[model samples]
Target: MKEGPNIAAIAALIGDPARANMLQALMTGVALTASELAQEAGVTPQTSSFHLSRMADAGLVSLRKQGRHKYYSLADADVAALLEAMSGIAMRSGMTRVRTGPREPELRKARVCYNHLAGEYGVQAYDSLIAREFLVEEDEKLVLSSSGRSFFTDLGLVLPSNETKRRPLCKSCLDWSARRSHLAGITGTALLSFFFDQGWAKRVEGSRVIQFSKAGDSRFHEAFSLQN
Candidate 1:
């Protein structure tokens, strides 16, 4: 018997089509009820509950209770990162869905991967940070430079002290659509929060899409020094 981790078991759990749909829907970083997940997965609520129970037991998802209602989300950033990486592999392998919808274009433009920005705009932001030397690669890991600290502080982004946190301050996530790395980890979350707080972008209802208004779009490009 193999002595390492049982990846096959986890893969089997995620291999189901209905559960995959439910999991993808939660990638928006939104907690969802079983009924909502049922709608997303095209399954009955009872079936959704069963799937949710299995996922919960496997630590792939976390559940929250609000009064009499229960909501579920991906367990943590790790799960989201895994899903995103899998998506990129599927895309590269041409395992795409047959039907493309209008939302496809919007999703490719800008969307949320868990709590951080992803897609084309996300790649642009990461590139800008690298180009401006706000972030640097050291020991094969993304590190926030001293200039990055000052840059973020000047932008009113309150960064968490590294000594107090278990998560890295800077990390890179591979964007599925753009096929490039984007910012992730603590700094990435802070940056996305800053955008929301400043009203530079907003999440689209019932989707992962992060829509930037015209003025907000301009501001984001100007701030990141992205080409028009």
Candidate 2:
């Protein structure tokens, strides 16, 4: 008998089409109701409920109660990271679903990955940081340098000090759509929130896309230009 965590069981739970769709929907970092998820998954409400129950039981999702309604979201950042990595693998392996819509280009340009920015713009931001020497790659590990700390502070993104934790302060999250690496971890989430707070980007309703205005696009490039 295998003497470690069971990957097969978890994979089985995510292997179902309906469940996969529901999980993907939750990847938008938004809590959704069963009915909303059913619509997203193209499944009946009863079927969606069954799948959600299984996912919750397996720890893939969590339930939140609000009055008479229940909302579901990915259990935590780890689950979102797993899905993002799997998506990168699937895209590289030529496993894709048939998809087409007006929002396709926008999604390819900018979208949310778990809680942080992703897609072309996300990759660009990461590259700019690297080019500017704000982040350093040491032994395949991403680390924030002294200058990076000061830079973030200047941007009003002062990271909370946590000495007891072992998690990396800055990590690379593979960008499935762009086939590159984007920033992840606590700093990444903070940067995304900054964009929202500054009104530079907005989440598209009922989707994972992050829509940046024309002015926002120009300003973003100015702020994180690779040439700098």
Candidate 3:
């Protein structure tokens, strides 16, 4: 493998089913402790920890220690982006959905794609912002305009202190099911947090499933002009 590119190395790192499941569960881009993650991947804590360590070594994830507990998450936005792209390939092969009972419309409607935002809900939000001229796209990345700062400020997010003109406002993430780009990046995370804080969405079972309440439904219609 050359220093510039190593597709085989990356593939080998994510090839294990357990590690793959762990990555999928953390696709929401939030930190989660090993126990919670164990449940998600259907593995024992010790086993999960072993996988976590391997992934952490591979630079696929990162861990933080807090008061005797360690929480794990994707190493960075780049890692999240990789998982989203991989999810797209999985879906293209007709592997994302399972016959595991009923349809999760709420989940399908809105949930975290990776670290940024995704799902039908994320797509709609991104589209609305674009319609309002808050952002523009070049190639695949989303560049924010000055208007974007004002728009986000109105929505109660202060721009990250780390942002630079060349860093970009958001990045396009592939939706596993929708097969389209959704907004993701520092900006997308902010919007998702705002939704939770505003009571527009509630996390279900501490998983990626988010249920929009009636108030949320109304608010989406009002704020974003979403009919559903």
Candidate 4:
């Protein structure tokens, strides 16, 4: 018997089509009820409950109770990161869904990955930060430079002085659609919140797409020094 982690068991849990759909739907970073997840999975409520129970036991998903209603979300950033990495592998392998929609372009342009920005703009942001030396690679890990601290602070983001053991301040996430690295972690989450707070972008209802207004789009490019 293999002594290491049982990846096969976790893979089997995620391998089911209905559960996969439900998990993907939660990638929007919104807590969903079993009924909502059932709709997303295209399964009956009872089936959704069963899958949720299994996932909850496996620590793949977390559940919360709001009054009489129960809501579920991915366990943590690790689960989201795993799903994103898997998506990149699937895309590279040409294992794509046959059904494509008009929103595909929008999704590729800008979308939410868990709690952080992803897609084209997300990739561009990471690239720009690296190019400007705002983020530097050291020992194969991302480190926010002193200049990066000033940059974000000037932009009205409060940078953390000490890194938490539980979550990173700066980390790279693989973008499935752009096929590149994007910012993820506490800083990334803060940046996305800043955009929404400043009205630079807004999340589309019932979807992961982030719609930037015309002025907001211009400002985003200018702020990130993204070439037109």
lDDT of 4 by residue, 86-147 (tens): 99999999998898688999999999999999999999999999999999999989999999
Q: For residues 1-228, write the lDDT of model 2, one tens digit per residue.
A: 669999999999999988999999998999999999999989999999999999999999999999999999999878988999999999899998787678878887999998899999999999999998899999988888899889889877888665224455787898888989899888888899999998889999988899998888888898788884
What lDDT does the true structure give each of the candidates? 0.92, 0.89, 0.76, 0.94
Which residue pairs clash in candidate 3? none
Ranking by lDDT: 4, 1, 2, 3
Which ten contiguous residues of candidate 3 have the minimum total lDDT? 96-105
Where does candidate 4 have its weakest 10-residue lDDT segment? 219-228
lDDT of 3 at 138: 64
What local lDDT does model 4 show for residue 3? 100
Count of backbone clashes, every candidate in sequence:
0, 0, 0, 0
TM-score of 1: 0.96
TM-score of each: 0.96, 0.94, 0.84, 0.98
Tens digits of per-residue lDDT for model 1, 1-228: 669998999999999999999999999999999999999999999999999999999999999999999999999988999999999999999999999788999999999999999999999999999998899998898888888889889878989777324478888999999899999999999899899999989999999999998888998888788543
